[model samples]
Target chain A: MRDDVPLAATAAGGTRGDEECCTLATGPLDAADAQRLSEAFKALSDPTRLRLLAHVADQGCASVCACDLTELMGISQPTVSHHMKKLVEAGLVTREQRGRWAHYSVVPAAFAELRAFLDLR
Target chain B: MRDDVPLAATAAGGTRGDEECCTLATGPLDAADAQRLSEAFKALSDPTRLRLLAHVADQGCASVCACDLTELMGISQPTVSHHMKKLVEAGLVTREQRGRWAHYSVVPAAFAELRAFLDLR
Candidate 1:
């Protein structure tokens, strides 16, 4: 819901040479970072969205069309669009137009940031 | 919300030697796993809860009392208790009672499962 907090910026921020590790165990998270992560996690908090994302991620280097997702997930096109919009806005997924349909792919950096944040060591 | 999908069972399921890797990139998640993960993610979807979890995780080997979290997060006792309840129910955090106050700690395996799920490899 907090689209104001961009996952791309947080992922980029984590890579700066002097930056401290972004894991939750390292230290208390500031409000801004917490906002960003909570937004990303919220985008992932739905079962339908998680399955949709997994389908896309499972494709590896290949991208999947929105129409294919609707068919695959057995959901309406509008529902797919709604979930995809949330994922793209949260920066976990990227959308690109190919002809009339939109194609999506997982943004590796975003997932990496999330994974890094969960690191308890 | 959907607390029926226990995270401890999922974390334990991941450790079975014959089990497939749990990363989202590897395969499509089944309905049950999706339900479980969504519940965990939903619990983490709030900013206050994320900061609260981080504070507990930052303690490493130690646990923090609920009273201490109320003071550190600058929130009222009820708010802290509410967030803590969500975290504990999701299996992302553990609760223990010592005398009058509840103590909390991060569940490392729960976080490891989340981190693993994000793997885009």
Candidate 2:
């Protein structure tokens, strides 16, 4: 049995023929999009990371500094850095360096895309 | 340092007083809710499982049969069964057995809750 199905060439939930299906409910998710979504989900699979994300997101448009995260989370600089790195790599959040510290903000589009997928209606 | 945060009594993105905050944007995510959200995300971390979810979701309220999934995914019956189990455990999908076949349907509320967290705006 060919259990190892080949990844679909089309982007995840991309135009499948004439139908304009984007979310999971609209149609089958392509392999490429699945890979991308899975990575983002993986980044959010950890409790600590989720908390950190919540803290950063709580700040709204205001970016949270790495130094502040160290105190808020009561974790070491490296621990916060590690989690922040994962969040940034997953495209869930954006990172910017301002002076001596790195600031992070939620990428609204990313969450919206994920929310759209779950919105079955 | 108390890096290991104790789980909060409130639900994920639940009320923090009269403030009426119900999402990641409003306030910090408690450990209890973080663990729940992380587990749900863990279920979506697999590409194969995600594809399966999309397929099930595509069916909408109609529901998808396990036998059909085996053929649709081009994977073994056992493999499909395994993945389905995880989705079911994660509360991403609901399963019902009819006759000799197992049917699966997406859980809208579960996805809605997860989507709310990502809805930073």
Candidate 3:
């Protein structure tokens, strides 16, 4: 998603402070924000990706290497890497390089934001 | 989306009690469960659907009628009805017919399940 468009613009223009009050309700969502959020959810639409996220969360503070993921997912190394990259881009997981292996961990804030987005009456 | 296949199957089958501990990380997800969950996310992938959910939620405990949704969404009556049917099928919203009008409200439990599904870390 492009970062050029600001989220505050699409919000009902009353006052700058009032933007927070005009949530997903009140009116139509900003096209850019909706597209961005949809992309995140699309990335999560896959079961493999969901499993990967769960793996990282279950590890607590520890991270899982690419090699570890390959066996766990029953997928090829490149496939695992691709999924990891998608997760990283979606901000659902963070990757750190440790020598030759890439270690991945869950990003709690990203998940929290997604949860907040899903909140309904 | 079929409810027949149990979630406990693909989980590492050490014991029935161990199923609860498996979570999404321990092993590959059951194909049926993944498909069902994917369909739910697919139903929610649309911006219009998200807006509908948000509107119902913003109304607090009150429900919105089909006529109200058509005005708010600027969509045709049939289109709104179709979206409402899909939302009801996904369990994201519940519908109650008030005479000729159908009043729809958010199903908090369904949204909660979705939020829980998105829990990464």
Candidate 4:
């Protein structure tokens, strides 16, 4: 009922847990892959996360400073950090620490994997 | 942490409720659209939902019978119904009640909209 719960918290899998199910044209999505895939989608399940991702992608280069994310997202530093942590855990974004600030970037391979998995093309 | 909660349940928007954020190459996703888009992805965030969707898509026809879904999914009729309700609410699938059976089909436009929204293609 609490809508603010991030996707990281949402895609926590069933009591059946690690069991896999279903087949696509490619093949069945096993439990491990499905679990990981769901987590990635869950990361994108939030508006803030989507914006955060856009901000990173909007950077267009390899990465952007963590400090820059706070300004771009128009959110408090801690809030941005929270969402970025979830995104990083989901593997949607990669973080690199430089000097004192962490830099974040979109992982094209993650997006590409999702695209293929969804067969959105 | 209960992963069984559907994406419709997951993308319930923030307490800020119905506010929009972030821009893609196309434009910023409004709160309503972000909510809707997130719901679609949330639906996909589950392996069960993904499998259900695949079964429907595998039908290759415009629709599949609700009764048929119960068999294909290998879940109980009620469990299938529960997930189907969430999918319906998400606008990912369409249901038509015919006689005593409800025939379900994937909404191409919903997937198309998500594809464009995510820039997944």
Candidate 5:
């Protein structure tokens, strides 16, 4: 996953304000970058969604069945589907539909992008 | 700042499920840690808050005056105050009042803790 990603470009979305939002690299998170990142974090703001992320990451980012996620969360199937949609929209997790079920996993580059700005030694 | 922090203790509140919420170290983000992290990220979930963080950080963790933030954001003083209050509650930023105005700075360890979990390459 790391090999496929050009780290700099991933964080800085070229013409977008990605270059500016570097918490450590440049200045403050630029407007464009802030807009993008805020959406990602906003999706993560909910407790249920965080739990879903935890479950997926726990399975080693393996494609966890959406049905199992609904069971673990004890939320309605529609509610789980809603949370998954948000995560997918945020680009934090990927969804793969196997027949009637959807599988979820973390997007490493997305997590890495968030982690990098906070990495000031 | 880091030396004072017992990283384990910080991440895992003894009574809380901090140990269980390990996105990398353990299986899932336990309920307690998820609650905590979700709040922190929730504080960051807004564009205005993200901008405030960026502005404060751009100053090299130096204390930023509330007045300056108000002007920079082009928002009402009350709105800026509200956002800063949320950041403080989330433990992402520190608030220091010098006379009538408040000064803000980043909480390094807080950011570090968030980074650690996402450190899995």
Candidate 6:
């Protein structure tokens, strides 16, 4: 994915029409939005997930497969997949299927929005 | 508090020596650190808490009292106090007592750290 592209767009595989880009303080977030955002944060709250995020981010812009994550996290494939699912669903990570493997990377805009949400002033 | 002050520093109320400011990507966060950070996010996960956070953040740099939150959230005084306690304990908000009132403000450094934690790259 192009680094210059918006996070939601990158997550959608360069398809910008599918998602909207907004900051947390742009306006009031509804309960559902807050709940959804909270779930993403909750998923990241775990040490395993935090490590998983660190691994993926450290890999440069490249995405790694679930197999690699399983080995790194010392967890089963299913468990890694579950965490990946949560990360992907939360827009924290993006998954792309290439041949027999799926690659994951961090979504910048999602991170930006979350960062803005935590903006104290 | 001065707007230019760092978050942890501001939370410490001009006592910068008491806190250290750092980002999530700077290094590995241990389990206890993750646990503590998660608790803060968990405190922010609730709708009422989110609203409270929003209210406090929206008030510029000024801190709000528990009495104001109880009315805004439509929650009881004890419940608001409890939520305030959680927020303060988590380090997401700072508490100051003036006479019989307890004023709370968002801690910027805490928000910055959390925002960094959410950073995908």
| TM-scores of the candidates in the order shown | 0.80, 0.79, 0.67, 0.73, 0.76, 0.69
Model 4, span A69-110: residue lDDT tens: 676556887898899999999887778776777777666567
Tens-place lDDT digits, model 2, residues B1-121 = 2334322311223213323322364367888999999999999999999999998877655567787788898999899999999999999887888677787877767887887777765
* Isolated chain B TM-score per model: 0.79, 0.79, 0.72, 0.71, 0.75, 0.70
- The better-scoring model by TM-score among 1 and 3 is 1
DockQ of each: 0.25, 0.28, 0.13, 0.11, 0.21, 0.11
Q: Estimate, for each residue in B14-106, the C-alpha lDDT of model 6 and write its tens digit.
A: 222212221236345566776767777777767666767776666545566666766666788888888788788888777877677677766
- Candidate 6 per-residue lDDT, tens place, A1-121, comes to 1234322321212222212211236445667767766776776766677777776665544556666777666789888877788789878777877576566766666776777777543
Residue A90 lDDT in model 1?
A: 100
Instruction: Tell me which residue pairs clash in candidate 3.
Output: none
Extract clashing residue pairs from model 4. Answer: B20-B31
Model 1: DockQ vs. true structure: 0.25
Candidate 4 lDDT tens digits, B34-102? 677777788777767666776665543346666666775668878888888888988877787767767
lDDT of prediction 6: 0.63
- Give lDDT: candidate 2, residue B82: 97
Query: RMSD in angstroms, all models?
Result: 13.3, 10.0, 12.3, 15.2, 14.3, 17.9
**Candidate 5 residue runs with Cα over 4 Å from true position:** A1-23, B1-26
Question: How displaced is residue A85 in candidate 4, in Å?
Answer: 1.4
Top model number, lDDT = 1
lDDT of 5 by residue, A1-121 (tens): 1234322322212332323332454456778988888898898888778888877766543456777777777788788889999999999888877677777766767887877666543
User: All candidates' lDDT scores?
Assistant: 0.77, 0.76, 0.63, 0.63, 0.70, 0.63
Score candidate 4 by TM-score against the native: 0.73
| Candidate 6: Cα lDDT at A68 | 71
Query: Native contacts retained per candidate?
Result: 0.55, 0.54, 0.21, 0.18, 0.45, 0.22
Residues B1-120 of candidate 1: C-alpha lDDT, one tens digit per residue: 223533222122222232332236547899999999999999989999999998887766466777778777899989999999999999988788767778777677788788778886
Which runs in model 4 stand beyond 4 Å of their true positions? A1-30, B1-24, B27-30
By lDDT, is 2 or 6 better?
2
Model 2 RMSD vs true structure? 10.0
Candidate 2 — which residues are off by over 4 angstroms?
A1-25, B1-26
